[model samples]
Target: MLQAKVAVVTGAGSGIGAAIARLFAVEGAKVVLGDLAEGGAAFAAELADDGFEVMFQRVDVTDEADVAALMQATVARFGRIDILVANAGIPERKSPIHQLDLDDWRRVIDVDLTGVALCNKFAVGAMLATGGGAIVNMASILAHVGQENSNAYSAAKAGVVNLTRSVALTYARQGVRANCVSPGYVDTPLLAQLPAAVRQAMLLRQPIGRLARPDEIAQVVAFLASERASIITGACINADGGYTAI
Candidate 1:
């Protein structure tokens, strides 16, 4: 359904971002993958070997220049950007209102909140040139609920929730659509890095008794970006495994 469309996915080195990129390519989108880590390049190479149209760039989501180049490079290579999956984000462990380190708080906010802002800033301009496009921002289940020692992460994602709504309203008449996907803990490398106890707690949050698979989250992203979701905008889809419902 995304045939001929160009999609840019941030943090595509691995995990949920990578899953989104791979799925988009399978749906016929020319994919632009970006990550601060080297994994993005390697993943793109793997896709190239498989005959998928893809490009990779090492990008710092917090950097305006990096994001601008991503947009520029995408248009340079694929002519236009029709889809943007702003999936790059970081979660901080110390988020207690009193004990949270100021620096860590800033870093989380910069990457999680500011990063999405930059992607939208540039992507919106590019999309405007083409009349409009679809944007899917990666939020977290934490955005809606609170957790001990998760203040920074929670605050930033809460910002994403409102930010997405604002952007949706801003571009509604311009043919642009903005939506958010909030996924609970997923079985990704990132989750594996968490303390065993923390990981277990994460699994228990969902009534399903297991973490989500990255590909499952990607499926929802694909639908929202496709024509099927043409009427959906400014909505937040909880991709969590019934975590939010409880």
Candidate 2:
């Protein structure tokens, strides 16, 4: 799998990012975990105690200096970076487009869209210098379909999807591969924070009658990051449990 690789996963404190980091570690990558939450450090410590090569760094992805330092720290510790999972993002509460607060809209866009840009800026430069690497940006089902009252999230994710393609095309010849994963209704801690009714409604909308598990998304990411997907780049793989099929 990822043996000998140095991998960076944003938002690795929990949810899909944490799952990806754990999977990469199990597959033999030295994992560098970053997130704004303190839990990210604890997660890294726990994994390191279990004998995994893991490091934690506090980062607000939206901040330029923080993201640059995150990449530099990983390189300093691991020597070279082989993979990047741009999975840090935030979702806004539901609000009609007309009623959506300007601040909330900017918040989502900053974290979801601009954050990925900053990560890629540093990650790609490192990858190019190291000869080549792989990237998996976490998008969402909203990237393709409409999600009422989630304009900012949807728009940001859509931007991620396109940004992935652009990166893939621009750097594939240079040995850098970029792809995206669009997940639907994953039962992460973030979902637990939603209102009971909102959660239920999401569950009901899933054709499988249950939310996607974080590991499921991680499996897809692992595949995209592996040599098995060597010919795959600029692709968007959907893990929506048929949510967009209808």
In terms of lDDT, which candidate is strongest?
2
lDDT of 1 by residue, 139-214 (tens): 9999999888888889999999999999999999999999999998898887877789888877767798888999
Backbone clashes in model 1, listed as residue pairs:
none
Alpha-carbon RMSD, each predicted model: 0.8, 0.7
Q: Scored by CA lDDT, what does every candidate get?
A: 0.93, 0.95
- How many pairs of residues collide in model 2? 0
TM-score of 1: 0.98
* TM per prediction: 0.98, 0.99
Residue-level lDDT for 98 in candidate 1: 78
Residue 126 error, candidate 1, Å: 0.4
List ranges where model 2 is wrong by over 4 Å. Answer: none
Tell me the lDDT of model 1 at 129: 96
lDDT of 2 at 6: 96
